[model samples]
Target: MGRRILVVDDEPDILELTRLSLVREGYEVETAATGEEALACLRRSRPDLVVLDLMLPDRPGTDVCRVIRTTPELSDVAVIMLTARGDEVDRIVGFELGADDYVTKPFSPRELGLRVKAILRRGVEEKTESEHLKQHGLELDLSRHRCLHRDEEIALTAKEFLLLAALMRRPGRVLTRERLLEEVWGEGIAVTLRTVDTHMKRLREKLGPAGDLIDTVRGVGYRFRE
Candidate 1:
C-alpha cells in the first residue's frame, strides 16, 4: 500500500479537498472531523503523516499534537498543522509543538499536497543514505531514524532528526540557514529562517552536551565542529 496520511479538519469541504489532493498524489488518505476522532484514528491506523488543524471542535489541535508527540508508539509520526491564522507567532507555536510544517487557511490543495510530499520524501531519502553517522559521541542511525548520544537514546521529532543528520553529514561546514532550510525542510514548503532556529534549539536540548558540537557562525549560519 502507498504511504498513509490522516487528515484532521472540521470543515467538510476542506477535509474532502485535502483527501482528494493527496489521493491524486498517490497517498492513502484517511479523514477525521474532530480531535478525538483524529486520536482514535491515529491509534487504529497509525498513519505515516497527519495533516492536523490547529483548531478543533472537541479540543485544540495542539493538544492532539502533544498526545502524538508524547506517546511512545506514535511520537515519530510526522505532523503538518493547518490554521486560519497566518501570523508568524502562530506558525512558530506550531513548530514549537513539534509540527513538521504549517499551512494557513485558504491554502491551495495543491500546495498542501506538495508540503505533504516533501515531508514524506524526506523520510524516504534518509533510508537511502549511509545508515550510521557518528561524530563526537553523537550518533545517528539513519536507517532506524534513531539518535544516540554516548549510547543513550535521545528521542527527537522527525524534523529534529533530519536537521541533526544534515549537520552531521557535513561536519565542519558552515551551513547557512538558507542551506539548512533547503536540506531539511526541502523545496515547496513555506518556512522561515526562525523555523530553523526553533528546531535547532530543540535539537540541541535533546542532544544535551553534544549539542555544543553545532556551532553558530554569527550573522552567517551554523556549522558542526569538525
Candidate 2:
C-alpha cells in the first residue's frame, strides 16, 4: 500500500540492493535494466517516484529524463537521478531536465529513502499550493507555494520557487550567489552556487515578460525588481 517506485539501473546488484531496501520499507518497488525497458515499464506501471541512474546501456539517463518530461503522459512523475560522482554539471543538468533530486553512487539506502519520502511529500504540498495560487496576479503566493504572473499560472520547480522567494524577500536589493544559496537552499548540502544561477535562468525564462522581474546584479548576484 506504500508508494510505488521505479528504480532504473543497469547493474543487477545495484538494482537488487535498491529493490530490497525499498521493499523492506513497504514501497512497491519495480525496476528496469535499460532506458528502453524503463519507458516500457512506465507505460504499464505508474510509479509515484523514479530513481534513475545516469548511465544506461541504451539512451543516457539524462535523455531518458528529458523524454519523460517531454512526454505529457509521464511528466508528473517525480525523479531522483543517481550520479557517478560529484559531477556538478550532471547534477545541474539533471535538475534542468526535471529530475526532482539526485544522489551519488555508494549512497546510503536510508538517505535515498528519506529523499524519496521528502520528494513525495513536497509533490503533494506543491499540488495543493498550485491550486490555491490562482488568485495572485504576477506574484508568488508564498504561503501556498505557488506563482501567478499576469493571471497566467507559472510552473516553478521546488528550487526555482525557493530562489524566487529569496530574491523577492529583498526586492530591489542585489543578492550574491553565495547568499542566495545560503538563503534558498540553506547552508546545507554543499551544493554549488551555480545551482542558484541555473535555477534563476530557468525561472526568468518561465516568467516571460515578467522575466525582467529577476535582474542580474552584474558583478554580484541578482535581485528581484520591486
Candidate 3:
C-alpha cells in the first residue's frame, strides 16, 4: 500500500481539499471530522502520518496529540499540526506535544502536500551505514529511532531525532541555520530560522549533559562538538 495519511479537521471543505490534494500525490488518505473519530480510526489502524488540526469540536487537537505521543503504539506516528492561529506559543506547545511540523490556515494545499512529502521522506532517509551512533556519551540507534544518554533513554520528537542525526553525521562541521533548515526541513516549506533554534534548544535539553555536544556557532549556526 502507498503511504497512509489521516487528516483531522472540523471543516469539511478543508478535509475534502486536503484529501483530494494528497490523493493526487499518490497517498492513501483518510480523514476525521472530530477528535473522537480520529482516535477511533487511529485505534483501528495507525497511519504513517497524521495531519491534525489544533481545534476540534469534540476535543482540542492538543489533547489528541498528547494521547498519540503518550500511547506507545502511536508514539512514532508523525504529526503535522494545522492551525488557524500562528502564535509562537501555540507552535511551541504543538512541538512540545510532538508535532512533526505545523501549517497555518489559508495555506496552499500544494505547499502542504510538499511539506507532507518532505516530512515523510525525512522519516525514512538513512543517513549512515551503521545503525548506531555513539559519541560524546550519547547513543543514537538509527534503525530503532532511539536515543540514549548515560544509558538512560531520551525521548525525542521526530524532528528532534532528525536534527540530532544530521548534526552527528557531520560532527565538527559547522552547519549554518540555512543549511540545517534545508537538510532537515527540505526546500519549499515555509519555516523561519528561529524554528530551527527552537527545536535545537529542546533537542539539547532532552540530551541532558550531552547537550553540550551541540555547540552554538554564535551568528553562523550550530555544530556538533568535534
Candidate 4:
C-alpha cells in the first residue's frame, strides 16, 4: 500500500490497463505517454519501480533505460522492461542498459502485478545482512527484478541477470557452459555457445570496472569470484 510505480508507454490503452492493475494492488501509480514525460516525472519523484515500454515516442526505450541506469539520482530504482519485442538480442540490450526485468508484450496483467510486487519487495533489502557470498558490492532483489553494485544500482537483462545470479550462488566454483545454459536459458532449449558468449560480454561491460567479477575458466566454463 505504500509503494509507488511509474508506467511509461506510448499506448494509451496499455497505460490505462497497467494503471488499473497497480492501483488495485494498493499502490500509487503515475502514467507517461512519452519517454520525455517519464523522465520528467521521474525527476520530480522517485518511484519504487518502473514499468518501461521498449518503444517510446521520443528516444528509444533502450536510451531511456540507459539514462536511468547511468544517473546517480535514479540509481536505486528498479525497472521492468515492457515491450512488444521479444527477441533475445533485444532482451540483452535491455539488460545491458540496466533493466532489472523483461516482460514481453501481451503479457497477463495478473502475472505482471505479482512480478511488480515481488520486484518492489526485493529492492529494499540490506545485502550485507544476507548470508550467502552473494556477489558482494552487488545486491540482487529478485522480487524487485533489480540489482545494486558497490551501493550503485546496475541494471541487467533478464537472462544476463539469471546467469549472474546462478554463478554468484556457487561462488568460486566453476559452472560449465552447458550447465549455465541449462539453468539460465532453460533445459531442452536449443541454443548456441556464441549466444552465451555474447550475453556474457554484455553483462561484463555493464558491470563496468567490476566486469572481472565473472571469470572465464577456459576449456571448462566460468566462475564467479567467491
Stronger candidate by TM-score (2 vs 4): 2
In model 3, state the lDDT of residue 70: 92
lDDT of 2 at 95: 54
**Compared with the true structure, what per-residue lDDT tens digits does model 2 show for residues 105-217?**
88999999999889998888777663232221467787767788876678898888888877777777999998887887777769887877788889889988888877888
Q: What is the lDDT of residue 80 in candidate 2?
A: 90
Off by over 4 Å in 4: 89-95, 127-226
RMSD of each: 17.7, 17.7, 17.5, 18.6
Model with the higher lDDT, candidate 2 or 4:
2
TM-scores, one per candidate: 0.56, 0.56, 0.56, 0.54
Model 3: lDDT to the true structure? 0.88
Q: Deviation in angstroms for 18 in model 3?
A: 0.7
The reply for model 2, stretches above 4 Å from the true place, is: 89-95, 130-226
Pairs in steric clash, model 4: 95-157, 98-155, 118-143, 119-143, 119-144
Colliding pairs, model 2: 138-149, 138-150
Candidate 1, superposed: residue stretches over 4 Å from native: 88-95, 127-130, 133-226
Per-structure clash totals for the candidates: 0, 2, 0, 5
lDDT of 2 at 13: 96
Local accuracy of candidate 4 as per-residue lDDT tens digits, 1-226:
2298999999899999999988998989999989999999889989878899988989888888888988999977888888676785455445577787778889888978988877777775543334333465866776666777887888899998898888888889999989999999899999996788899999999999888988899999989988
